[model samples]
Target: MNTIEKQKLSVLIITLNEELYIKSLLKDLDFADEIIVIDSYSNDKTTAIVESFKNVKLIQNTFEDFTTQRNFALEKASNNWILFIDADEKLSPELKSEIINTINNPNPASAYLVYRTFMFKNTKLRFSGWQTDKIFRLFDKLKCKYTTEKLVHEKLEIKGEIAVLKNKLIHYSYTNFDDYKAKMKRYGMLKAREKFKKGHQPSFIMMLLHPIYTFLYQFIIRLGFLDHTNGIIICYLNAYSVFIRYKELKKITSSRI
Candidate 1:
């Protein structure tokens, strides 16, 4: 009897009270050889749901900056081939096939940039500065890891060759208008804290201009206006987030002084 070996893939996902979406995402990652979830002691049924899945291995750690949490996940991954995805992100059938083929190739890139389609409450955002959204998802664990010292947007440092995949990874991050606003505010707060750590002083000129520039950049320059009301709403929210970040930064700086 001859058996063909399948390429080993270890999927890593970081979570925090993601009971609402993680179960469905875990189901989609069933094809992976191993699925490791680094949860931040979620006070929800997220762990319960994950435990129900036979293939998933759940580990709890206290919540911290995004980079620290993601790096922790990377340390827990067993296989060298890693596919890092969020609880709100999922792979389409075509993307799943492509990833399998890529992993099986003898000479694949050290890491790959996967395009992400942003969805806002069931609407696919074709604009609002999200059209070119991409991230390094699939990669060789030995060759790549998170590097940027940010508390919000964790960036990966990749070594050797990099390539882009054809299929887009679906992102169901924001569920509704309120959900978007809540997330924006939280991200803004985290970003402000990161800036404060870097000794970024509060500037009145930046406070006034950054948000305005952000609105213009998103709405006018990025063609977000063409996406109509949805785009308009996101652009406004994005600008508001910038305002919130500066506002929080001022508070943090004042308290320190």
Candidate 2:
């Protein structure tokens, strides 16, 4: 066992009915000094499971945009060093060790980006544009914050230099096809709402070609065909998600006009 130098690190997570993956995620996060979960009133065993952990603190809030929920979590954290992780994500042993070492030895950078390896139905995906998946997860709360521009795919904005970690974060993104479709639909709606609010007008060209282009780019250009059935399904669903978003945007625009 490696004796890591103690560092005050707060692990922050935002959840909404994520009972399936919450327990396992929390278990792997035992190394954190405090685990703060900002839930959107999940009517499931999510809260109960989190309560089982001694170091975890759960706060229930109404469902809002991703940026708002994440920023709220940041304010609730006691420590300066914050690691924002989703319920479906678990820290690999290598990542855990790397995080501990990084925090112990202070760096001039305000945040660190970690790569993620996505799993679909328990199979790790190597292609389909998932190989280069990375996000800024670990950061100093005072120096970094999520941008409010994107309602669905919110990204952290750092004030100073950004460092990259070597190890990958394990992400169990989808259990089955149904789960994947459901999330894509939900995200599409959220993205459409954001665009509508920004006064984006839907064009017939975009509605017609965007989905087709998206499918071809991911499946053919990105080598999504390498994953076989999983790749095809994911690429098709992704294209479907784009179509749904634009369709909803058109509806909203038509109603306004």
Best by lDDT: 1
Q: Any residue pairs clashing in model 2, and if so which? A: none
RMSD of every candidate to native, in Å, equals 2.1, 3.0
**lDDT score, candidate 1, position 52:** 98
For each candidate in the order shown, give its overall lDDT on alpha carbons. Answer: 0.90, 0.88
Off by over 4 Å in 2: 1-6
**Each prediction's TM-score against the native?**
0.94, 0.94
- Ten residues in sequence with the least summed lDDT for candidate 1: 2-11
**What residue pairs clash in candidate 1, if any at all?**
none
Candidate 1 per-residue lDDT, tens place, 141-173, comes to 899988757888887788899999999999997
Residue 41's C-alpha lDDT in candidate 2? 91
Q: Write the per-residue lDDT of candidate 2 for residues 136-232, one digit (tens) a residue.
A: 8988888988888888888788898899999999899979888889888888888898899788989889988999999999998999999999999
Going through the candidates in the order shown, the clash numbers are: 0, 0
